[model samples]
Target: MSKVEITTQNNTKKITLSGHFTAMDHDQFRAILDDLQSGEGCTACAVDLEHLEFIDSGGLGMLLLLRDACIKQKLALSLTNAKGDVLRILDIAKFDQLFKVVG
Candidate 1:
């Protein structure tokens, strides 16, 4: 199961994603993206992956989608709190340079 909690403050949106980000979590991921995109005015967005347990290629694709969407919308998007295996994946995929990884 996947659990994605979102917290919004001012123009910044924080998405705390946990659990396996795979085919099963596609809907949840999509919903989160939809909600963020639907906001009236958002200047920044951050996805916190510190609690993420497992991620497959699908998860990576989801991240890419969000990144692209944010870029097109001129929103400052960042990923934070990645550790261990998750950090490795982002490094291998060269996503660390493509997106801002903080904390």
Candidate 2:
């Protein structure tokens, strides 16, 4: 399972993911989406994957759910600092096309 840490600053919500991300993380992820939805007037949401060690398809789905939530909230969504296995998985999955990716 993954650990999610969320913080907001300068109208941006940053979500940091660590450990392995998979279906098991769904319970925690819901709170994340709720947070995003409730961030009124937020300009962006950034998902930081720098410390994430691994991700499964279920994790990818959760990201997609986050994307949709961002869209409805008019928040720009970005995936940042992905590297190693996490980066490769995202690239192979074409996440770059779905979200703004930054290092």
Candidate 3:
């Protein structure tokens, strides 16, 4: 299971992902995308994975989808605060080449 929260400030949207992220979270994550698409004035998005404990390939795919959406919207996308297993997974996937990652 996973927990997701979204908040926006100063024209940036912050997406917080915690616990486990797998294919099962697809629907939940889609809803998040819908919310983002319907809103306006967001110039950037930061995905916060500080509390995320695990992420599977599906989770990585989801991030890619989000990145695509951000690009279409001309919004900057960044992955932030990833650590432990989550950070390791991102590294293995070479996501740093895809998004700006901040420690």
- On a 0 to 100 scale, what is the lDDT of residue 78 in model 3? 95
Output the worst ten-in-a-row residue range by lDDT, candidate 1.
Answer: 19-28
- Residue-wise C-alpha lDDT for candidate 3, range 1-103, written one tens digit per residue: 7999999989999999999999999999999888888659989999999999999999999999999889888899999999998999999999999999999
Model 2 residue pairs with clashes:
none
Candidate 2, residue 63: lDDT? 97
- Candidate 2 CA-lDDT value: 0.94
Give the better candidate number (2 or 3) by lDDT: 2
In the range 5-86, model 1's lDDT, one tens digit per residue, is 9988888888988877776777887888888778668899989999988777888898988898888778899999988888
Q: Model 2 — TM-score against the truth?
A: 0.97
- The most accurate candidate by lDDT is 2
Model 2 residue 1 lDDT?
Answer: 84
By lDDT, the better pick of 1 and 3 is: 3
Q: Report lDDT (Cα) of residue 23, candidate 3.
A: 91
Q: TM-score, each model? A: 0.91, 0.97, 0.97
lDDT of each: 0.85, 0.94, 0.93
Candidate 2 off by > 4 Å? none
